[model samples]
Target: MDLVRHLECFVAVAEESHFGRAAARLGMAQPPLSQRIQRLERELGVRLFERTSRQVTITEAGTLLLAEAREVLARSESFLAAARRIRDGETGLLRAALTPDVSGETVAALLADFRRRHPGLELELRELSTAEQLAAFAAHELDVGLIHHPCDVTGLELGPVLHRDLGVLLPRGAVAAGLDEVPLAALTGYDLVLFPRDSAPAVYDDLLTACARGGYTPAAVRHGRGTSFVRGLVLSSGAVALGPRDTHLLAGPGDTDPDLVWRPLAGAAPAWRHSAAWPKGRGDAAVGAFTDAATHALRTTAGARFEPSARPLHLRPASEYWL
Candidate 1:
């Protein structure tokens, strides 16, 4: 009869691909389902399905609308569920894109504890980069994201967890061995081994600015598309980099790179903010619960290693750009 009814009927028929099953799922008869589809098509002035005596297939328009309808329905239900939860104080799935970096152990423990405390809530975890993670949250594909700090992500609510300072990981006295501990300033004189620009473009750009602030132009020795690759490069090459001390997850204490040592940067070492973020204006209980869990996790686990991301400084709702 209206948009919501049309969506419900259309989605049911599409998924079942058989009018009988769809009608059954909707607790209606086949004839009503057929009528609803026809009414929806008349309203839209488009054929949404192609029908033969034996089977039914969705038209291109139907395909497009199917995804959207499903999303709308889910989100609508989420809203209803959120309202009911407000009355009953319950929660739903806590979809999250979590960045796995320094606080891996901490994140695990936090999630585990949350799950134990709130068994009714479901957490869907997707491992993604800083950009991908933020984009997912903005698109509403993810309810929340635990991402690397310092990027201007538009269209999300950001809060600080804590702060972790950056240091140069180098060979012992590697700073003396044609290297410098002053990360940004040292860029001009030594080979800069760092993550590729694609992984975190803003970070790479910021590093450039940091270097320029030191009146230096960094010379890149090697680039890693991923973390492990960069660590491999650092192990063998005579280069230095500036990042969070915990970022050296690829290397360990007993894993002695006789040449590698960590030194605090002279200027503002590229510090990272690890915080919980979500799409703006979403008041779903799932979203709220996830944010609460993540906040608690990051707060207790992050300790002094993470800080709140500066939202005023970066783009708002940065999800749209990435998506």
Candidate 2:
């Protein structure tokens, strides 16, 4: 028997105190309503009603069960409503990550926007590189990630790609920094300061390829995972790091590394592409919200732009360079 249905019939009959009236109120035939009550009574081993040709009355057992039945029905409704809320992503935990190279301002803007758009969602954000995010996705430990492109994304779905033209971050006193814009061949002898290759191998290799194509191959490539560390290398080691024009924002407030300057390459030689990624077939409203917020933050705060004719995303070989 459908227990809830039987309970409804029982309650209706008890309240109406007449089989014909109860059946009409339930929008069912009197015989079926009576049969359902009989089945419920058989399953519970109790007679729920005292009936006669003249009148029908709820028995003591029915009277005691009526309140409990109503409570169960209310709880069922509450359970379904809660399930729907979660399905709609109205209230739940969303595990999200961002690449470390994203500027602080962009991260802050994304957080503020996501919170504003989805006040009920609890966001657990983490700083992870492209490779680390891929691992997290594989392990099912992450929900969504703002990841750098030109990396492996075989099993993931991507959001719209945003592009940021890269410039060289060099010591302010360097001769090349004196120029309004730095040409690729101008700093031939300097080493390159870049993030560890393992952090994002494809992007790392593709960047090196682009530099070589522009006639600016470095003497050596030095790895620095943090902005301050990259700046230190550029200052003390005579190396230059590639970054967006707003790379100074990575520094703390009132602590913009005055010794370092970002100069655009003559042709925007190398650009960084980014997009939101999640496992295929796993997107939900929370993920979509994060993706939208990330795109907006990257464009506004990170000075990123979307290409009108963006190419398909895939792992490009290090032998080829892309703009």
Candidate 3:
């Protein structure tokens, strides 16, 4: 028996108080409507109505069940509505990550834009490296991440790739810092302050390779991730750090240091590439929204730009690409 349909018939007859009127309201023949009500009464083992030639009157039992039937219908409608919202990615928990090197301004931009776009979604953002984000994706722990390029992406989907040209941060007292632009080969005696190799090995190795090609190799590679840490190493140890043209990246807030300068690399300086990534077959609307926000933040806040011919530059060993 179609229980809901039977209950609907019962309710209609109870409210209409006449078989002819109930059938007309339900857009069904009077005989079929009466049969449905009869079946409902049999199923429940209770008579729901008293019918005479003059009028129809609902039973006390029928009156008691009317409110329950209406409540069930209302609840069913609410369930379907919630399901639609989930399917459309309007409400849920979304786990996202950004690399440590990302500027503070870019992080704020990404958060503000993503929230504006998906106010119903709860964003759980974290600071993670490309390596950590990839591991999280493999373990099903992360939904989306802004990751540095040249890392393995064997089972991931990527968003638009953006690039930021890098410059050097050196002590202002250094001879090379006096020039309009520092050549890669100019700082022969300075050690390099770089992020730890384990954080992003592929990018780490690629950066060293680019340095070698440009005719400069650091006396020693000092690993650090925090801005203050890198700045301390650069200032105290005479080490130089490769960074974007943004001086605040290394100088930190309220830093009016007279001994620090950031200058563009004169030749073919390396460009850092980034893109939003998620597990394969999981590029849903929420992930797409995050990717759009990340791309916008990188472009507008971090001064990164999309390259028309963007591709992973250091995926393989350098020897593999040699002519």
TM-score of each: 0.59, 0.87, 0.84
Tens digits of per-residue lDDT for model 1, 1-323:
57777799999888889999999999999998899999999988989899999999999989988888999889888888777864543555667777645457666766786676667766777777778776676666876776665665577776555566666665565544344446465545567676655555665566566656666564554676456666666666766666665555435552365646666677656565666777777646555556666667655654444444434446334221121
- The TM-score leader among the candidates is 2
lDDT of 2 by residue, 44-63 (tens): 99989999999998999999
Looking at model 1, report the run of 10 residues with the lowest lDDT sum. 314-323
Per-model C-alpha lDDT, please? 0.67, 0.86, 0.85
User: Predicted candidate 3: what Cα RMSD to the true structure?
Assistant: 3.5
Question: What TM-score would candidate 1 get against the native?
Answer: 0.59
How many pairs of residues in model 3 come into backbone collision?
Answer: 0
- Model 1 regions more than 4 Å off: 1-91, 149-152, 176-183, 186-188, 254-259, 283-285, 292-311, 315-323
Instruction: Rate residue 111 of model 3 by lDDT.
Output: 92
Output the better candidate (2/3) by TM-score: 2
lDDT of 2 at 46: 93
